[model samples]
Target: MDDGDVLTSAGVAAGLDLALHVIRRDHGSEVANAAARRCVMPPWREGGQAQYIDRPLPDEAGGGTAATREYMLANLDAPLDLAALAEHAKMSIRTFTRRFREETGQSPAKWLTGQRVRHARHLLETTDLGVEEVARRAGFGTAVSLRQRLHAAVGVAPLAYRRTFRAADHVRAAAAEEKA
Candidate 1:
């Protein structure tokens, strides 16, 4: 996991993720993605090392939902229900659902929800946007939904999460200033 200045990984595959994350963070997604393609790996895997275990790789002939996953990431605010996702994957709804779960160990809804929550948290930490706007952009559609999801995810309201991260950042900045 790439936690700010500290990056840690429990296994070899996770180390690859950590390296890709650093590349994505420093260079940009395009560069990281190209590197991933060169290495024949997924550009990014959202969760921790635990999620990497026992998941099937995309088929050698390239029949995987990776492109759909990338599309989903690119359009987080879009309504990406099972039908839409199935269409994007060019598979039947049942087949897409089964293959997605087999490849990712998570249902489509579950994975999409996790991605939304992660996006919401990123916006909260990095931007001064209002909660409702954050909610909308994160695809929760409403503040109430965002609150429910984020609270379920991190045990805090959106504002509290923002405040905590901002406070920590402020403290870090102040400490760095003193060092300078």
Candidate 2:
């Protein structure tokens, strides 16, 4: 509904989204995400997205996945599999799988792919690396795989994503280098 210059939300959850929108709009996404992290909330969720999901949130009850999560992040490029992750967590496959889903609200593979994509997005935004190089760095193996995953996730090709998210400071640095 429209109210003259006024904003409203459907509920308390929606209010969080609205507040995040205001913060992101004014202070930028990095700041907003940092604030969200401090509160132990997930990163930016758009207003139009589902307000609730069935999976248990990290703030809810769960355990034994934290150390494994850190290890996976530090080795995103590694060829990780269920057995390997389970071994790292010192649990059997069945137990690790259950605990992972409970803690992260997604399967280990899904979470790993998302993390890889996030890292790919970061590399694309921050560096001038070719798509193939970014793919290798981000563990996609080949440019075709990178293209498919990046497109499916963000609806953009790698180069286009680079252009979209290129940091302003990087542009200035490039310009300065060109002058020198």
User: What TM-score number comes out for model 2?
Assistant: 0.62
lDDT: worst 10-residue window of model 2 = 48-57
Would you list the clashing residue pairs of candidate 1? Answer: none
Clashes of each: 0, 0
- Model 1 regions lying over 4 Å from their true place: 1-63, 173-180
Model 2: residue 34 alpha-carbon error in angstroms: 38
Say what the RMSD of model 2 is.
Answer: 11.0
lDDT for position 118 in model 1: 86
TM-score of each: 0.62, 0.62
lDDT for 63 (candidate 2): 76
lDDT of each: 0.85, 0.80
Estimate, for each residue in 1-180, the C-alpha lDDT of model 1 and write its tens digit: 557778898778878888898899999999999999999999988663222122233453554788888888899998988998899999999999998888777898988898898899889999999999999999999999999998887778899889977998889999999999
